[model samples]
Target chain A: MEQYFVNKVIENNRFVIEDSETFKHVAKVLRHKPGDVIYLVDPEQNLFTATIERITDDKIETSVNKLATPSTELPIDVTIACSLSKKDKIEWITQKSTELGAKKIIFFSSKYSIMTWKKNVIEKKLIRLQEIAKNAAQQSKRRIVPQVVYVNKLTDLVDHKAQSNLVAYEESAKQGEISLLAQTLNQNPNSILCAFGPEGGFAPDEINFLNKSDFLSVGLGPRIMRAETAPMYFLSVLSYKYELTVK
Target chain B: MEQYFVNKVIENNRFVIEDSETFKHVAKVLRHKPGDVIYLVDPEQNLFTATIERITDDKIETSVNKLATPSTELPIDVTIACSLSKKDKIEWITQKSTELGAKKIIFFSSKYSIMTWKKNVIEKKLIRLQEIAKNAAQQSKRRIVPQVVYVNKLTDLVDHKAQSNLVAYEESAKQGEISLLAQTLNQNPNSILCAFGPEGGFAPDEINFLNKSDFLSVGLGPRIMRAETAPMYFLSVLSYKYELTVK
Candidate 1:
């Protein structure tokens, strides 16, 4: 069954989709006519099995059967605060991270970051990234679509509070500082904020600031991952530790 | 410091670079002069800090200063046997998996695989992937560059023996089969062979074959990952379990 994210709320066990894009995708592209079954994911991440009842010129009416139980979301909320890299790499990271169960993604400018988001076109870029996240979420059967946020500086992440904070620092791996992330996740924090650097990595001042702010510097492994590969690795390890390792 | 993988072996504390690509990169791109230091990783995965002694028209001579310890290779060997995906995705997998410490990558044809490799061009493609692995290994400062191998079918992997074998099955994930991968890794298998499907996933027959061959069907997480992302996730999880989480 095909799945589509809708913006409307279900009322009296029925909901009408008025969005032109989704309507076209269902009624035109997928050719989902009356009596066809499809899944509708609401804003709250609740999935419903819906059967198409009627179709109008600009809208589609579907009868909600029941709520589905299986969730594709991770047990713990993970927010990736990564330094904005080159254009293609950032988009790739957004798509892959969404598939790996990231709850939120924030791209910020670091001391060594090369790309800077322009003020006037930042909204456009955000929209593109959000679309990528949505497509990836649907393809991966994720319950929630991750939000993509852009910030001007690393300090911007300080305002976004989480139960735990970590920075993917390569120096820690060089010094063989292992088990920090595992130990932190073992506490079962409701949410986690992980920060990654750009091509040149975080500057000394940035590391000091993160350290002072109680952000534990964690290492992915001994190998030096590219800027785009770090967050995906972080999410994968999180999934393995929190989801796969648990019985 | 920049690192390069050389084919020559060190003899009497000196080695001459003969490979055209490495020679050009060292002499033309880096513009290294006499007495400049560079790190060379040999075929044996040994890292040597060398000083440039002389630069001739054909080759550059360097005297080995000392050997470096603390390798970046994983404790256990991991081979990713992925169904041949699109050109870019397979290349991306090779590069990222190399950075994540995969010892070998084998691309084989699956029942649902979209792209098929031609026999005449397969060797060339393997060389290209090998070059990508080499570059990634150098960038990640890995001790060994992963070998890229090509095969015809899933059963071909039966010839490539490993202590542990796993297949990333989405159905297993949907069925909520967790802890299998962690349990297998906890046994500390000296080598592992993990296989991933193409976009459409494995055919039923392939799954049956894997099951009969004692390849455990493993779930990555609740979310579905792309073909390229699965191997990277597997390697990341392996690194976390065997390397990072170790005290």
Candidate 2:
């Protein structure tokens, strides 16, 4: 069953999907008719089974029944703070991060960043990335779609800090610093964030500033993944540590 | 500071890059003249530092010095076997899997596979994917370029079984089959391979055959990942378990 994120909270036993994007996807794209069943996640991160009762020109009315499933979100929030790259790479980071259980995705312009969203284009680009996150979240059956944010400067990442902050520094991995990431996850902070550098990686002063700002330098592994692949590695490890490795 | 895989072993303290691809990349693409240094991984999986001696008309000659750095490969060998997907998706899987330390990558035809290469095209497709694996492996500084394989049927997977074989089943995860994966990892299997289904997932009999063939149905996590994302998750978890999470 396809999952759609609805904007409004479901108060009654019924709901209507009025968003043109959702309506078009459910009605015209899939051509779902009355009696068809689709999953709906509300603003409150509640999953409901919506049985289509009527499909009008603009909206689909459905009878909703909240499912008893637990939230699929990770136990701890993980925000992947990455330096901006090309358009496709950042968009891919957003989509893959959402699917792998990122709570928030932030893109910042670092000293070595190849591209940064201009003041005029930031809003449009963010909106597009946000849409990609929503669709990926729905496809992955996530209750809440992750928010994607953009900042012009790398230092701005301080504002989005989680309970524990770390930067994925390649130098750390080169120095055989394999244990810090696991050690950090061992503490089990309420929420954690890991900042990934762009293809050129963080300049020395940038790493120094982040280190001073309390972002511990850590390594994902020894392999040098592309800028985009690094965050997916981080998110997947987070999932393995918190979600899958329950003994 | 790029890494290239040379087909021949480094004899004494000298090596020659005879491969046309590596020659062009070192000579024409990167334009590294004499005295520029590069890392080389030989056929024996040995790492060596090669100082450019001369860029000849055909091959680049370099004086090699073996580096004592430990291997970057995962302690336990892992292979990601996925049902054939679209061209872009499978290619992405190959590249990401290489970056995440997959020792082998296998693509097989399953019931719900969207497309399959005919015998004539199979060689060509595998070459493209293998090229992708090589580039990703070099970019990630892998000791070995993972071999990419193709099989016509799901049953062929039995021929490639490892110490612990797993099929990433959505039904398994939905049933809350969580502990088995970690448990299997705990056994310290010398080598492991996991098969991933296509977008539509494996057919009942396909799963049955794999199960009967001793392929355990393992759940990755709570959320549903797309066909390509699941293998990356699995490989990342393997790296976390074998490489990083040292007690």
Candidate 3:
């Protein structure tokens, strides 16, 4: 069934989708008619059941069926923090990470980052990335669209709180450290943040700062992965380790 | 240090890089000056220490110092037989899979695949994907480039012998089954072949075909992944399970 996230909870036995974009999608693109089933997730993370009854140019009216209890969110809130990559590549990461159950996508400008968008372009870029996250969320039937944020300095990361933190580093690969990621998996914290570097990678000084912040270091593998691919590799493997393997 | 693969074995104190791409990369792009160090890997999988002695637009000269043995080629040759996805997405998978050490990439047409290129377009697409594999191999410091091939039928797969065979299926997910990927890793065979579907995914009849061919079915995870992302997720987690976790 097609899924959409609505900010308001179900009232009575029906939910109204008045948002223009979602209304157009459910009513126009999907061409859902009366009696067709669809899912609506409200702000409280509660899933509402609805059957399309009436479609207007501005609103989609659906008769409520019942509430849903299943959730696609991971037990832990994962936030991927790294320098912004090229536009297309960042979008790729956003989509895949959303599907993998990320709660937030944070971008920073590292000392060695290859490309940095102008300050004025950041908002537009972020909006586009958020769209990617939204689509991926709907495709994966996720209840939430991970937020995308921008940070300009290391202090920004230091200010954020997560129960556990880790950075995937090539130097860590050289050192043969496997337990950093494994230990994080073992701890199973309320939230975890995994960070990656940009094209030129984090400078030695940057890694030192991360180290001071108590960010554990992890290694992906022997082979050197490109900047964009590393995060996907990390998240996918992490998901497999905790979600699939344990159950 | 930057790394380049060379053809000749380092004997006593000398090695030669004769491949055109390696030559151009070392001689032209890098403008490697004498006394500058570059890592070289030979066909025997022996990495070496080499220093540039001469530099020219069309050629470069280097002398070997010592043999270094840093390699991650799996004991088994793993081939991924999948349907072609969108151009950029498939290219991304090619690059990441090469880094994860897949030996061969094969594209087959599945009954429900969304995009199918014509015979004339196949060769060009394959070549482009091959280039991605090559660059990924170099970027990851891989000694060999994984070969990319295209086939028209599932019958062709049965003809290729491998110690183990498997297919990833969404049905397995629906059944609440664990991924066979971990089990496949445990086999640690000389080689394995894994297959994945395109965007629309494999038909039920196609799954029957794979079953008859002795391909065990597995689920990647509960959440659905895009066609290109599935193979990368499988290979990365496999590499982690075998290469990283074990040793």
List, for all models, the DockQ compared with the true complex. 0.85, 0.83, 0.61
- The collision pairs in model 1 are none
Q: Model 2 residue A93 lDDT?
A: 91
The C-alpha TM-scores of every prediction are: 0.97, 0.99, 0.93
Candidate 2 error regions (>4 Å): none
Question: How close to the true structure is residue A244 of candidate 2, measured as C-alpha lDDT?
Answer: 78
TM-score for the second chain in candidate 3? 0.90
Best by TM-score: 2
List the RMSD of every prediction in angstroms.
1.4, 1.0, 2.2
State the lDDT of candidate 1 residue by residue for B1-247, as single tens digits. 7788887666568888888988898899889898999998887778899889999997989888557568888999999999998999999989999989999999999899999998899999999999999999999999888999999888988887589999999999888888899899989999999999998999999999998898999988887788888998999889889887885
Give the CAPRI class of candidate 3: medium
For each predicted model, how many residue pairs clash, with residues at least 3 apart or on different chains? Answer: 0, 0, 0
lDDT of each: 0.89, 0.92, 0.80
Q: How do the residues B1-247 of candidate 3 rate in per-residue lDDT, one tens digit apiece?
A: 7776666666667655667788888777777778888987766777777888876665667787765455657556889888766777677778878988899988888888766778888889889988888788877877787899888776687866478888888778656666466666777877888899987888898889888888999887767787887888878777777666664
- Looking at candidate 1 chain B, the ten consecutive residues that score lowest on lDDT are B6-15
Which candidate model has the greater lDDT, 1 or 2? 2
Candidate 3: pairs in clash: none
Kept native contacts, fraction for each prediction:
0.86, 0.76, 0.59
DockQ of 3: 0.61
Candidate 1 local lDDT, residue B196: 92
